[model samples]
Target chain A: MVQPEQIKQWIEAGLDGARVTVVGDGHHFEAVIVSPAFDDKSMVQQHQLVYQVLGEKMKEEIHALSMRTLTPEQAAQQGE
Target chain B: MSVQDRIKEQIVSEKIMLYMKGTPQFPQCGFSGKTVQILQACGARFGAVDVLADPEIRQGIKDYSNWPTIPQLYINGEFIGGCDIITELYQKGELQKMVMAAQG
Candidate 1:
């Protein structure tokens, strides 16, 4: 089982500027990630970016991961 | 036919296609169940494949869409996100618009 902090760290390491909040019970996780990289991307593209960052962990460690990807601007607007 | 070919045919043939863990009436996964509810709420007439019932499709779908999860949605042969994206889109009323456009 992967820790939430590990997930957070991986995302932060992968994206240039990212703020990720992860909550989970080992297997299933939910993430709210704000990143400059997400700007101008569609929702599917935004998610694919995150998925690419996680790499093989997405297939092996994480049983389920639901994400809310946002641009820094959108995150600020939403007060996230 | 290859699995990719089969998936291509499935997605293109259905205006709104859902590859889920189980049927709408009996969703095996919570995410799948929630997705079904969202689609029903939108009054979307979608075709669904219970991946749990078909091992080939269960695995083929992930590769087909390059997405690592179940409960994936496709509209007009395009890959939409999974449960999270679907819920967000439905909440923002974008999903309804897409469904309307597809049905028209």
Candidate 2:
């Protein structure tokens, strides 16, 4: 079983200054990833970057990952 | 025709196309089901290809899009994204606007 923290660690290692929250039951996962790298990127590009972090885990271990990716500005705007 | 050529033709022919796990009326995957719902919610009449039924596409699409997932969406031959991106767009009411723009 994959721990949420492990997923968080992987993402953190891949992205700089990323605020990541992941919750899952080994098979399925949901993540809200806030990162500076996501700025000026398209939604697909943002997700692609996060996907790059997980790599083979996404194919072999995790069944699904529903993610909400945002930049710091977008995250702040979300609070408004 | 080569698979790449065929894939290109399909996208070129359909203004709105979805490559999903199953048919819109009876989706196989939850992500595919949700994506179908969102597309319908946008009032978009789209063409759907059930990737599960076609092994080549099931594997080929990942290579084609460089994305390792099903339920990929295209509008006006533009690669929009998969379920997550679509869900975010839908929540922001941007999906409907995109659909309308594609239809125009």
Interface DockQ of each model: 0.81, 0.78
lDDT value, residue B43 of candidate 2? 95
What are the lDDT scores of the predictions, listed in order?
0.92, 0.89
> What TM-score does prediction 2 earn?
0.95
lDDT of 2 by residue, B1-104 (tens): 87777888887688999999989999999999999999998999899999988898787777788788888998888889999999989998999999998888
Candidate 1 local distance difference test against the native? 0.92
- The top-ranked prediction according to DockQ is 1
- RMSD per candidate (Å) reads 1.1, 1.4
Q: Any runs in candidate 2 off by more than 4 Å, and if so which?
A: none
In candidate 1, the residue pairs with backbone N, CA or C atoms under 3 Å apart (3 or more residues apart, or in different chains) clash, namely none
Question: What is the Å distance of residue B26 in model 1 from its true position?
Answer: 0.8
List iRMS (one decimal) for every candidate. 0.9, 0.8
The CA lDDT at A52 in model 2 is 84
